[model samples]
Target: MFKADLPGLKEEVTVEIQEDDRVLQISGERNFEEENNDTWHRVERSSGRFTRRFRLLENAKMDEVKASMENGILTVTVPKVE
Candidate 1:
């Protein structure tokens, strides 16, 4: 299982698994939108692409991997092979 705190990214995330190495990958991108009508005093937010990968154990069930995002949190569940 893996959990990630990804704020402002609801439906812009992607999860994948590598077939040969059994690696789990989670990725997403965020874009910053600016309104020209407003004068900005300070801008602290950022936007870019991010990716995280983890190697699965030998007992991991690659076919049953599941992922969900809720309230800016991303949860990935990888069941163990029996």
Candidate 2:
């Protein structure tokens, strides 16, 4: 799960898995603020597309992989096939 102050919902994230290579990619774009020519004493905010990738186990059930976002947290489930 990814934890952060992100903008957008579960329906707006990109999640993909490659069965042949056992690779999982999770990506999302965050957009929720306009600078509006404001001066910043402390700069602490993020925007644009965030991407993460991982190499799954050989036995991982790539076809059943799923992703979801809730309350700025991203959850990805990759079941192990026995």
Q: Which one is best on lDDT?
A: 1
Task: Give the alpha-carbon lDDT of every model.
Answer: 0.89, 0.71
Per residue, candidate 1 scores C-alpha lDDT tens digits across 8-44 of 8987899999969999999889887667776776667
Task: Please report the TM-score between candidate 1 and the true structure.
Answer: 0.87
- Top of the candidates by TM-score: 1
Error of 2 at 35 (Å): 6.2
Candidate 2 residues lying further than 4 Å off, grouped into runs, are 1-10, 35-43
In model 2, how many backbone clashes occur?
A: 0
